[model samples]
Target: MSWDLSFMFDDLLPALLVGLQYTVLSTVLGYLIALLLGLLIAVVRRVRVVGPVAHGIMEFIRTTPLLIQLVFVFTLVPPTVTPLTVGVVVLGVHYAAYTAEVYRSGIEGVAKGQWEAARALSLPLRRTWGAIVLPQAIRKVIPALGNYLIAMFKDTPLLFAIGVTEMLMMAQRVGQPAGRVMEAYTLVGIMFLLVSIPSAILIRRLERRYAAV
Candidate 1:
């Protein structure tokens, strides 16, 4: 039997589009959270007073499986009357933990003289970070951060397990009854590549631009 692309375009497209919207939203929001939280965590790690706390937090997050954390947030926590807002928050928090280490490495890679110069000026803590350290650290790490963003985007599909219907879930819905699993799955993969590949290229260009500066 022949597979009909027309049927997919006519019927399944709407569901896929909706799912794609959610996927995009989740990734964007999650990345925003990751960026701010990760930087804060990195800064904390750098400060000797908070170093132990930062180390413990990082170790816990890195050692745990994300899937298990997802289940706990979605399933078990709801019994205490917490909303699914908590679940999505957990998802963002968990990923932010991973991203934090990425940021820490970036910050630590900066020259010690930079921090010393900022201190020598007697600049306020926030101003020092805002003016000097962060600019250099973040610029140097843009490529690595971009890679994390891509991974986070792909991981959005796992939200389906918690009843958040995303791209992969849409593919399953489209393919299950029609028995066009290959076609539906293939289409989803193509769409992901279409979105991710260009972003990755742009990130590489950014890396080069920042590196040149």
Candidate 2:
């Protein structure tokens, strides 16, 4: 069948746009959780007694499939929680495993002299990290985090596995019953391209700008 430009722009676009809102919301909320939780995991992994355990958990989470994680959370959490909520939290925790490493690498990138300088100044441990370490580390890692946000944006389609009805699912809903697939699916792909491509370029520019620092 020939492409239906009118249907794509009219029917499919609205459904996909609604779905796109969910996609962006999940990506953003999920990434916010990832940033906070990942930082905590990174910090906790430095603890002498619990470090290895934390590292093991991080590895386990990293190695597992994200879809399985989402499904598992859906089953494990109380029924009162919506699938979208489960999807968001699972996405956050799943990526937190990866983001922790991002944070760890960022932390390692901080100069040893800086650590020594903090010691030399006799700053409290918390203050040393708060005032000196994290600010520098976070600056270096902002681009990396932006990349993950894009990754999360792409991954939002997976939320449909748990019935969350993100973009891909919306495309299928728009297309399947109508007995045509190309227009709706193509629009969804274009929607992703429109957002992701420019975002990727911006992140690359940011990475270069950060590197020049």
Candidate 3:
């Protein structure tokens, strides 16, 4: 049949809006986790303070498939817990692997002279990282981190697989009664563009700003 979005606007809009709310919330929480965990991993790698163990952990995460990680987090955990929280946490942890690499590049982008200067000043490791290293690293990585955030936003639809009822799932549910799967799915696509396009633009602006710094 022809694509008619009236059903989506009339009936599914409310539910879709709710789904978007959950999507935004999940993205935010996951982003915070990605940022902190990524920065920590990057710092550990940069200092080489943790030696082989840190390298091993980073390599393991990098090498492994994130979908497998998602499955483990979803099915291996206690079933009593809410899937929404678990989904967000799973997304966070899975993407943190990618974020760790982004952070490492940012950290490495810092000039060697900066590290030498910090060392010569007798700066403590913590102070050097906190005051000198991380500032530059984070500034450099904001665009990359923003990319991860956008990726995480897109992945929120995957939460539907775990029964989180995100946008794609909502569209599927709504389409069943109307037999308008094409319209519903197309609407979902447009909605994603609505959100993701602006996000991408903002990320580009942020990249320009970071580059200027």
Candidate 4:
């Protein structure tokens, strides 16, 4: 079929932009969950006894396909939970496993002498972690976290599988009605690139800035 630039610009693009709102909302909310839960998971894994279980669960979460997790969470949750909520939550949790590792690596990057010095100064555990550890760790890993945000935004299209009408799904709906899905799908990809590329460049700049530090 012929490429329908007019239909793409007038119809598919508009529909995709509407869905873009859900896509952005899911990514932002999901990333917030990941940021908090991932830090908690990282801290929890420092305990020698509980660490193994957290490690095992993180391993399981990291290894599993996210689509499966989304489906499982949807099935397990109460009926009142909206699909958008499910997507936000599942996306957060799925990425949390990864972010946990990122946090761990950031923590490990702290100098051993810093830990020794904190002990020598008799710093309270909370103070040591809050003042000496997490700030440095989180700062070092901010770029990594930003990359994951971009990845999550890209993955928001997967929400379609779980009935969240994100950009790609909206495009599909716009196009399938007339059996001309090419323009719709094409615009979806273009929009993703438009967003993801600049974000990636900004992250790269941050990575360079951090590396210099």
Candidate of highest lDDT: 4
Better of 3 and 4 by lDDT: 4
- Over 135-165, each residue of candidate 1 has an lDDT whose tens digit, in order, gives 8888788888888889888887778777777
Model 4, span 78-139: residue lDDT tens: 99999999999999999999999999999999999999999999999999999999999999
| Candidate 4, run of 10 with poorest lDDT | 178-187
**Model 3 per-residue lDDT tens digits across residues 1-213:** 565667778888877887888888988998888777777776677565684676687678767866666667779789898878888787777778788888888788889999999999999988998899888888988898888888899888878878888888888888878788787777788888999999999999999988876
- Report the C-alpha displacement of residue 178, candidate 3, in angstroms: 2.1
Clashing pairs in 3: none
Candidate 1 Cα outliers beyond 4 Å, as residue runs = 79-87
User: Per-candidate TM vs. native?
Assistant: 0.89, 0.97, 0.91, 0.97
Q: List ranges where model 3 is wrong by over 4 Å.
A: 47-51
* Candidate 2: residue 114 lDDT (0-100): 99
By TM-score rank, best first, the candidates go 4, 2, 3, 1
Alpha-carbon local distance difference test for all models: 0.79, 0.92, 0.82, 0.92
Q: In terms of TM-score, how similar is model 3 to the real structure?
A: 0.91
lDDT by residue (1-213, candidate 2, tens digit) is: 688788888888999999999999999999999999999999998899988999999999999999889988888988899998999999999999989999999999999999999999999999999999999999999899989999999999899999998899999998999876888878888999999999999999999999854
Report how far residue 156 has shifted in candidate 1, in Å.
Answer: 1.1
lDDT at residue 130 of model 2 (Cα atoms)? 99
**lDDT of prediction 1:** 0.79
Per-candidate clashes, comma-separated: 0, 0, 0, 0
lDDT of 2: 0.92
